[model samples]
Target: MNTPILLLQCLFLVLLSGPLFAQRWTTTSQESEQQPLRLHGSLLFQGIYPGFRVGVERPIRQTDFQRSNGRVNSHQRAVLFYVGMYYHPGFHLNTFAGAEYIFRRVGGRGLITEFRSSLALSRTFLGAETYRVGEAGIVETVLASGQFYAMPGLGFGMGKVLGKPGSNRPFAYMVNLNLTGLAPYNGLALPTPTLEIGFRYQLATTSVHFRHRIRTRQ
Candidate 1:
């Protein structure tokens, strides 16, 4: 790939993702005001593109936390933006960016469960696929105007993050099930389901730092 193409791809993805998931789940406490910055990365498999796509997400704002249900637990909300890229050489290339929201709470036995939603825009370049004609097919047929289209999308997902209780960075794996709808395309842009597997990490651990102050002081 040329430098321009690579750069464009990166830029395209960044612009679509506004800074949003590997989608995530986090437990919160009312006493905590500002949460740490987080980074998430995901690999996607979906129906539209027929390939695996990857994305990087970063939470831009401090997480919001509040206690719920008269319990010792808290619910958290996160806002993030993401950049994603897709390419299949001769077939197609796509760039996307979007913002994500996660509403999370603790599930049974320390599992973090979340509700996620996103909106994004995408630009796609599709190449014509030639078919082998009739029998004794030495000839090929092309679908002219190898298409170009821009689409806007809305998606919703439910996900879980596995971890042990009281661990600051307890979870490494994120699992999600998503249903997405894209519009102004061929047919009705029906909802399609995709399975995404990803990971997340805290980039700046300010809270953990405070807890470790004694160690830092020594």
Candidate 2:
């Protein structure tokens, strides 16, 4: 694919997403001051191919609710921006950076579930020797043979917040499984399954009370 065109398309999508997610948090009265920044760390795996990821998360909006059983629940929305690299050794080394829009629901006992949409750009480097044949039948060594790919993903995750809800815990964690696709891989998109076991650390000491929207079930 054309690199410039692909880049422009990616930028367009990202720009469009801002206002779309913004519409979900329209209650100005519920908005608080800037939220705490969270740090994230994870072990990434693709069927025994191992790597690590580090990133930061920013809170967007949160809504709390009360269930019919008197249990308090919450929905939190955030964006996670990250960069990571993985190596297949002798095959290829893939490095990528991306942003995910996360929608999380916190339930009883601090159990949490989430859905995410992601977009990234992947650059892969050839790990093995490459050569090209010239018109004169001379073979020339190709150095730094690689390609760029566009990666888009969708995923779901589940985990716990550790401690009571609203306790302002210093840490929370989750395990995620994602199906990510890379485009223009041999002229088509390649689907890959990945796993992430990660945690987020709250860096700020201040706390904010998220406004609750409650509805009683019949």
Q: Which candidate has the top score in lDDT?
A: 2
* Candidates' C-alpha lDDT: 0.52, 0.78
Model 1, residue 65: distance off in Å is: 10
Per-residue C-alpha lDDT of model 1 across residues 161-188, encoded as one tens digit per residue: 4555422343545666766554545856
Which ranges of candidate 1 are over 4 A from the true structure? 1-32, 48-72, 87-91, 128-163, 167-170, 190-192, 205-218
Q: Indicate the worst ten consecutive residues by lDDT in candidate 2.
A: 209-218
The local lDDT score (0 to 100) that residue 10 gets in candidate 1 is 100
User: Hey, what RMSD does candidate 2 come out at?
Assistant: 9.8
The estimated TM-scores of all candidates read: 0.54, 0.75
Residue 15 of model 1: what lDDT? 79
Instruction: Indicate the TM-score of model 1.
Output: 0.54
